[model samples]
Target: MSSTAQTADTTVTIVDGRVVTPDGVIDGRVEIGGDRITAVGDSDAETDTVIDANGQLVLPGLVDIHGDDIESHLYPRSGARMDTEMALAAADRANVAAGITTKFHAISFELDESADRSPELAATLTDAITDATDLLVDHRLHARCEVTQKRCVEAVIDVIDNDNTDLVSVMSHVPGKGQFRDIEAFRQYYENANDRTAAEAEEMIDERGSMSMATLRERVDRVVDRAHEAGVVTASHDDENPREVEQLADSGVDIAEYPITLETAQRATEIGMTTAMGAPNLVRGESQWGNLSTAAGIDAGVIDTLVADYHPPSLLAGVFVDTEEPLHERVKRATANPADAVGLSDRGRIKAGKRADLIVVDPDPTPTVTAAVVAGQPVYHADTTIEVSR
Candidate 1:
C-alpha cells in the first residue's frame, strides 16, 4: 500500500470499550481514520486494527494545562542540569504512559543575577522542546515569568516574541508575603528539596524580601498586555487573596493557576477566569504547600481544570480520587474542562470530526491506562499480545 493509503487504511477500531465522552460513558467502538475519529458507536465498522478493550474505560487523552515538573527532569536539583533534549524525551514518554497527549511545559524565568535565569539557557531549552515535538505528543511552552525580575524581563519578552510561547503566567515570588509569606515554610521547602542548611535557607528568604505591591501590580499589567496582544493566554500564579484575583481578572487574565485561598478561587470563577488546580493536591487530599484545598475548590464549583503540576500520574489519579460527584463527572474536570478552558475545542471528547486523542484504560475497582493514542496513532500500548503489520 502507498504510505498515505497505509496510514489511512490503518483504521484503529476500539471494541467493547466503555467510552467516556463529555456526556457520559457508553459501550461502543471508536473508529479512527488517519488522524480523526470517523465514528464512535457500535456500528461494526471494519478496521485493519482492533483493540479488544474488554469493557475497559476509553477516555480522551489528558490535556495537561500546566506542568513544571519537566524541568525537574532537566535540572533535577540546584546547580545540576541534564541535556534538555534527553530530559524532554524522557518526560514525553512518561507523560504519554500516563495518558497525557497534550502538555504545556511551564518554564520559569527569574531575572535575578543570582538565579539561573540565563537568556541562553531559556533559548536552548525552548529549542530543545521545538525539536522534540516530532517524536513526542503535542508539546508547548508555558513561560512562568517572575514579575519582580525586572533585569531579565527583556530576555523573557524576546523569547515570547519568538512566536513559540503559547502561555505566559505572571508570578512574583517575594518572601514574607503571598505564596511564600510564611518564612518558616519557605525554609522547610528549601531545606528539604534543595539540600540547603536551615541557616542558608533563611538567608535566601531574607535576601529576597517582598516586592512592592504597587510595582507587582504594574508588572503584572504590563506582561498581561504584551502576552494577550501576541495571542498567548495569560495566567496568574499562586494568588492568595480576593484582591489579587480581582487584579488578575481586571487585567483580563484567562486563567488563575493554584489560587492559595478559597476566597480567591471563588472570586476567580465568579469573574469568569478559569481556575486551574493541581492534580497533586487532589490526590494528596490537600495542597502540600498549604494552598487552597483542591477538593474544597471542586466542591465549591470554583475549579475548572486539573493540571498535572509536579506529578504526571496525579492527573489521572485525581479523576478517581475526586469523589464529590460521579466518576465520569470528575473525569471531565481533567479532560474536557481543561481542553475547553485552554481554547482547544477539537480533541476533548470522543466524537466524529474531532482529533482522535484518546486512551484505553482498564478500570475495575482501580484504574490503569492500557493504551494511549494521539491523532489516531497508537503512541503507547501495554498489551503486547496485539500485533500490528505495516
Candidate 2:
C-alpha cells in the first residue's frame, strides 16, 4: 500500500474482540480516521473497512525501548554479514510480527577495532532505518556509547546531531568491574562467545583496560550533556551500585538500562530515573549474565519499563508471563510505561487523538499476533479471510 493511502481514512471500525483500551478492555467498536483514533463506542459507525476482532485481544502495539539484535542481521557473525538494507527490512517485519509498533535499535559505538564497532556499520544501519521508515513499523536509532571507546564518541554524536538518533545510552564496559565486576567472569564471556583461549582473552582485556573510572566519568558526562542538549533521551547502561546511579542522576540521565542490583535499581527510582529492564530477563526467569533479574527489580518497585534487549518477541511474551502481582499492572511496564519514558505521548495508549498503533492477538495467555497496525496502516495482517486495504 502507498504511504499516503494508509494515512487516508475517515472511519475504520474494529468490532467485537476484547478491546484493551487505555482504561481497560471493553467489548466495543473502535473508529479510526487518518492516523488518529476518532472514536470508540458500542454504536456502529460508518467506515471504509470493518475488522471482525472475534476472539482476539486488541491492544496497543508494543513500544520497544531498546533492541540491539538487529546488528546480528546487518553483520550476521563476527565477520560474515548481510546488506544493511536487507537486514533492516527483515528486522522490521520481525518486529511487526511480534506486535511491536515502535522499535529503538540500539546500535553500539565502541572504540575497539572490532568490526562490530565500525563507523561504516553504524552509518549504514542509520541510513537503512531512514529508508525503511515508510515501508515498515516505526524504527528509531538508540546509540549505546561505550565510554571506554571514547574515540568513537564524536562520530556517534554526529549521527545524533543529524537528528536520526532517538536514544543515547552512556555505558562503560571496563573488563574488571562495573557490569562485569569479576575479571574472571569477563574472561569467560570472551572465551564462550569468541572461542578465544583464556590467555588470549586476558591479553585483550589488558590491552583494552586502560580506561579508568575517572576518565569514564568525564567522557560520559560530555556525551550525556551533548545528547540531552540535542533533545535525545539519555540512559546509563548496566549500573551496579547506588554510586553509579547517583552519578548518572547527576549527569541528568533520563533512563537506567539494566541496573545490575536491587540497590542500584531502587536508587534509580528514588532519583526519578526511569529504570528499563530487559524483557528477555523476565521471560528467561533470570539474567543471562547473572545480573539482577527483572522480576526481582520489579518486585522492588524499581522497574518502570521493559525493553527487548536481545529478543524482540520477549516484549509480548513478557506481558503474559510477568506473574509478579497482576496481569493488568504488568502490562503497563511493556506498554504505557515505556512510551512515557521515551517521551512518545501520542502512540502508547488507545484514546481519541492518539496514533492508531495497535495489534490483534489471540486472547490466550501467551498469545500470537494476528494483525498489527501502525499509524492506521496494516503492517502485518494474518487473517487470510479478511482482506486488508492496501
Candidate 3:
C-alpha cells in the first residue's frame, strides 16, 4: 500500500495509545509535526490527521541493522534473478509492513557464490541502494564482505571510498569455521541452498583460496580503516569464539553480528561492542545452522539487538517471544538498542524531537503491526479498522 503523503505543515497525532518512550511507558499520545515528533504526552494539540490507536501500543519503529531479505527477493528461484530496483522496492514494502522503519539491507560481496553476489553486481546494487528514492521505509546498505576473498575486500573498500555503504561487516564463511563449525553441516547447507549434490558443494569449497590470519587481518584492517574514515559503522559477522570477538574488537569494530556462541557474545558485550542476534533464530527457538540460540543469548544478557537475518516478519515475532523481560525491554531489543548501536540518534525512540517513525501494535490475540508511520507519513495500515481522521 502507498503511504499517505504529507505536507511540511501537516500535523499528525497518534492518540490514546500506550506510547513506549525511552524513559518508560506512557498511556498517552504522540504528536508529529512534519517529520519529527513535536510532543509525546496526554496533552494534545490541533492536528490535520489523527490515528486512533485504540489503547494499543504506540512503539518506536524497528531498526533492523542487518537484514538479508533482499537476497531472496533478488533471487526468488534458482537460476532466476529479479530486477534490482524492483527487488528493493518489494523488500522496502515488506519491511515497513513488518514494523521496520529503518532497514540496512545486507548486500554480500562474495567471489563466486551466486551471480547476484558477484563483485560487479554487488557494486551495482550498492550504488542502487544509495540512489533509490521511491521506497516506503528508510533504506541503508550493509556491505557484507567475505574477507577470505581479496577481490571482495577490494570491492568493499571501493564502496567505502565512494560513500555507498552505511554499515560494513567482515566475515569469512570458510567451512569448519564461524557459521559453519562442522564441515558436514557446511556441505549440507550448500547442497540444500543451491540444489546441488554433496560432491558439487565439496568441489566449490575446495576451489576457494585459503588466506592466512595475517593476510586476513590486513584485509580487515583496510576495510575497517576506510569505513571509519567514511564515518560508517563496522561489524564482525559470525564470530566463532571469544578470541575472534576480542580480535575484531581490537580492530575497532563497533558491532558483532550473530556471534556463533554465548562465550563469543559475552566477550563482545564485555568489550563494549554491540551484539546482534537473528530474529528468526529467536522466534524459532534455535539457529538454522546450529549456532548460538537467540534465546540463549538473551538469557545470558549478551544479545543487544534483534535483526531480520532472512525473515522480515520475524523481527516483530521475536520481540514478543515468551520471556521474563517486560514488553518495553523486548521492543528495545529491536528498536532503541539497534539504533544506538549503529549511531542513528535521530530515530528509534518515541520521544519529542525524534523522527516520527512509529508502529501501532495490537498484543491481545497476537503481536501484529496494525499501522506504521515513517517520517510523519502513514506507510502501511493492515486494514480499514484503524481510524484515521484526515
Which one wins on lDDT?
A: 3
Pairs that clash in candidate 3: none
Q: lDDT by residue for model 2 over 136-168, one digit each (tens)?
A: 678888888877765667777888788878789
The TM-score values for the models, in the order shown, are 0.92, 0.93, 0.95
Error of 2 at 79 (Å): 1.8
Which is superior by TM-score, 1 or 2? 2
Over 290-380, each residue of candidate 3 has an lDDT whose tens digit, in order, gives 8899999999999999999989989998988977887888889999999988888889989889989999998767678998899898878
Superposition TM-score, candidate 3 onto the true structure:
0.95
As for TM-score, the candidate ahead, 1 or 3, is 3
lDDT for each of the candidates? 0.79, 0.79, 0.87
Residue 133's lDDT in candidate 2: 39
Runs of candidate 3 exceeding 4 Å displacement: 1-6, 113-115
Which sections of candidate 2 miss by over 4 Å?
1-5, 111-115, 197-200, 322-324, 363-365, 384-390
In model 1, pairs of residues that clash are: 177-181
Model 2 poorest ten-residue lDDT run: 1-10
TM accuracy, model 2: 0.93
Sort the candidates on TM-score, descending order.
3, 2, 1
Q: 27-114, model 1: which lDDT tens digit per residue? A: 8889898888999877876777777777778898888989977767877766678888788888888888888888888877764323
TM-score computed on alpha carbons, candidate 1: 0.92
